[model samples]
Every structure is written in C-alpha cells, then in structure tokens.
Target: MHDFIDHNLLARLSALPLESRQAMIGSVAGKHRSPHRGSSVEFAEYRKYVPGDDTRRLDWKAFARSDRFYIKEFEADTNLRAYFVVDSSGSMNFASGETDTKIQYARRIAASLSYLLVKQGDAAGLSVCNDKIHLEIPPSRSASQLQHIFNSLGELEPKGETGLVEALHTVAEKIKQRALVVILSDLFCDPEELGDALQHLRYRKHDIAIFHLLDRQEIDFAFDRPHRFVDLEDNSTLVAEPNLIVDEYHAALNEYLTKVEAKAHDAQADYQRIVTDQDYEAILSDFLTNRLR
Candidate 1:
C-alpha cells in the first residue's frame, strides 16, 4: 500500500537481476551465478552438444571442427544479502524543484531494491540513521518482510545533524557475513570521517556502493536574490545574496566532492552522484546494469 513501492515499478525492474563481482554466500539457492561451479545455465564451461541437446545453446564453430556440437554450461546461482543504509540527516529533506526531496527519493530507492531482491529470492535489509542508528532490519528473503522495510522507510523524517561515519561503522560490524552494502545519503558528513567509515566496511570485505544525493539548487547554485539561508540540521540562519557567494560555494562543494570520489576509488567502492531531479529508475538501472549476468 506504500507509495514508495508499487507493482508497476517492481514489474519493470524484476528483469534487471543484481550481481556481485566476487562470490556471495547466499542463504538460499537463487538465480545469481555463484563463484563456485555447479549446475546452472550461466555458461561456466562448454560441453559437447549431443543429439538430444537443445539447438538454442549449440556452438556452431565447435560443430564445424569435428562435426560435433557444443553446449555452454553455467555456474550455480545463489542469493545475496543487500543492505540499504539510508541517511536520515536533515539535509536530505531539501528539495528546490518539483521533484521529491532527497530523503523521499532515497526511500523509494531502498524500497524498490528491497522488493526486487526479495522477489528474486534474495534477502534485503534496512538501516536508517541520522546522528545515530534509528532502525535496523537484518536481511530476509521472506516476501512478507517487505512490509517491515516499507514501514521503516515511511516513518523516517530527516532531521538533526549527520553521523554517517558512526552509522557506516556500526552497520559494518553488525553484518556477520559479506554482503552488498548500498548507502543512500546526501553525504554532508566530514570527508575524512566518511572515508574512514567506508574503509572499515571494505576491511570487512563488504561490497560497497555509495549514492550521493544532491538537490538541483545545491548542484546548480542558481539562486537569484538575497535570502536567509537556514541550516536544516541545526536551524542556524545566515542572510546572504546568492550572487555574492555562489562561486565560492560551488568551488568548495566541488573540491569536497572530488575528495569523496577519490576516497571511494581508493576503497574500491562504487560511487554514484544522483541529482534529485533525475529519475530514480534510470539511476538504479545504470548501477544494476553493470553487474547483471
């Protein structure tokens, strides 16, 4: 019943399967190709195609060599644990355009991914944080568990300062096994602190992905007139003319973003910058497309 996730979006996204670059220890036998070889249609190796073999998978080149057909065999598929770590800091509530707030859009992403994973027989978990962890749900494959994830996401209201560093470290410790950790946030935390926390997850061997959400106004610096700029986290205000400080602000923000991107690369994390005006479906599709089987 939640608007964050709907049948239509789920139906469309179900085609896009999630994959991990390294092997995953799935809780149950699922569709993803496992690192270990087994019985699946993923084409791990080739075998001589026989008389009864389906022609669809036959290799004509192999047949031409010795007049014998070959069939490709695949490794076994397994499920993966997907952890959605969402930032509930006040900054994520900003929305300068008609599109939804960063937090709202993030919720849709977390919810949709959870639905997709669960529908594919994989497990999905939820973690909400702002200065501290507010809610935590361990990964689960049960379809009924999605209601819990949706309810948690729906209840999140972005407020207070961010403690993303503390959050990432805490969640990394909680997960007992390697998992796909996806972080959705505005990333307004200290850059060094952020890097350290993400590195902690990397040390644990968790596959990390960071979604850096920014509102259009933040990205463009398109403000025209003087106005009171209020800090959402602390409710602090400053009256300033946009034309005067836009250049300086852009320079500082870009420098900070560059550092974050470099840190992510150093840590081998998939870093994606998402603008609030962009469609979530397309963003997610691009991210998932790279790892699909």
Candidate 2:
C-alpha cells in the first residue's frame, strides 16, 4: 500500500466545526437538522395528548382551557448511520498529476466525512467496492473503528473493471436500515447500468448522494499535445489530436453529465459533479447546504 499524507489538507478540514465540516453528508444527529421530530428539549409543536401519552409531556396550561389532553412535542435526539460507498475500480486511479489522484482525493473525502460523523457521535462505516464489494464495516460509534476505516482506505488501489450496478445492488441488500449512502466514483460506466443501481438504492429508501469525481482536463479537453488516451479498465487506447475532437468530446461529456443529473433527480438523490482541481471544502460545503434544506 502506498500511503501519501497531506497534512495541510487535514489541518484545514480539522479546523472547521463538526457541523460545518459534515454539511455534505446531510444532517445526522449532530449539527445537521433532520426531518423527523422527536421528544427533545427543543419545542417543536403542541399536539393533542392521547390516553397513552406520557404524563410528563402533557401541557397542563393548554389542557386547562381545552378540557382535553395535550402534549408538547420536542425534537428527538437520535443517532444516525452514515455509509460511504467508495469505488476502487481502475478508472478511479486516473490522475493528471502525481500529487492528487482521484482515489487519493476520495480517501481524503472519506476520512474527513468519517471524522465529522464520529465527532458528532454518529455511526459511520465504510464499504470499499470495485468490480465487487470487498469490505463491509457495520455502522458503529467507535473512534477506533473510524481509524480502521482510514487505514483500510490507504491500502485500497484501483484494479479490475467497473461494476457499479452489481456493487450497489449488493450494498442495498446488506444495509437493512435506511442510511445516508454516499457514492464516490468517476462514473465511467453505462448510464442505464448506473441508473438501475441507483433505482435499487432508492427503492430501498436509502438517502443517496453521488459524488461524480472527474479530472478537469477530462471535462475541458485541455491536452496540450497529440497523445494516446487509454481506458484504464479496458486497456484500450486511441491516439488523436485533442483539438480536432475537443468540441465533440465536451459536447458528449456535457450530454452524459446532464443525463446523470437527470437520473439522480428522478431517483430523488443528490448529485454533484466534483472536478479534481476544485477545493474539497467548498464542494463539501455546497453539498451539505443542499442537504440541510
């Protein structure tokens, strides 16, 4: 395993408050607000108290006027489960520079997210998948377990073909409880296959977020000289002058991205395209803000 540490990146992320840091994973039990209201100190609303209502929660003042039982409802504090589905396929290893590979950036994202969740006392687990799902860590609120996740992430390498649909189906089957599933991948696969996988996850009522990782050069067709572009997974190569095909490539990429976004929307999942050149914190913050809404 090749371990590359970016202390500067970690330091920058560690400085942010837990809530502000994990805003992308959506609100869990921590700083993020959830849709479900429960019995907490924070008053949510007043409801008619039935016979089985807890006597402590009864609002006597309200009951006195109405001559009926009423209870004050407060938000409930509950632990949340977060799962990261990281792709370890060959395509994820693509990098234009030595300092940052797609997989490397993904590890950082996973680590930061795990740190935020653990800090907030939420159960966080990791499932590393390639052509098949290899590792499965059941969600738990253990700092040591999170450390294990980071260690495992460091060991992962890009290999084999991309079988996104198959892996997602397996994940949907294993996770019995509804959880926030964050998929980090380049998404270099057939749209139909990817759609089917997402649908399966949605059918199971899992909150899904797709982090579409890509290189800026790939998106912009910014290759400077004639070169042979190779498909990492298939070992297929094509040599051409990029300028001749740049327009068509951008058009195709844009169309594909649009279709992916549409599919995610239809599945009721959050989808964000992340370019390698952008700042991770900003990307995460934007996603979190959307999640909070």
The most accurate candidate by lDDT is: 1
lDDT of 2: 0.77
Q: Tens digits of per-residue lDDT for model 2 on 206-290? A: 8788888998777777887899888888789999998798889889988999888888888888888888878887876666556
Give the CA lDDT, 0 to 100, for residue 28 in model 1.
76
lDDT of 1 by residue, 1-293 (tens): 77777678778878898777666767578776566766575567888767887777787877788687788667877789999999999998999969899999999888988888888778999988888998889889897789899998998999999978899999889888788999999999888888998899999888898899998888888888998989999999999999999889999999999999888888899899989889888887888897765
The estimated TM-scores of all candidates read 0.86, 0.84
Model 2 Cα displacement at 9 (Å)? 5.4
In model 1, state the lDDT of residue 7.
Answer: 77
Q: State each model's CA lDDT, in order.
A: 0.86, 0.77
Q: Which stretches of candidate 2 lie over 4 Å from their true place?
A: 1-37, 42-46, 60-67
Clashes of each: 5, 3
* TM-score of candidate 1 on Cα atoms, chains taken together: 0.86
Q: For this target, which candidate reaches the highest TM-score against the unseen true structure?
A: 1
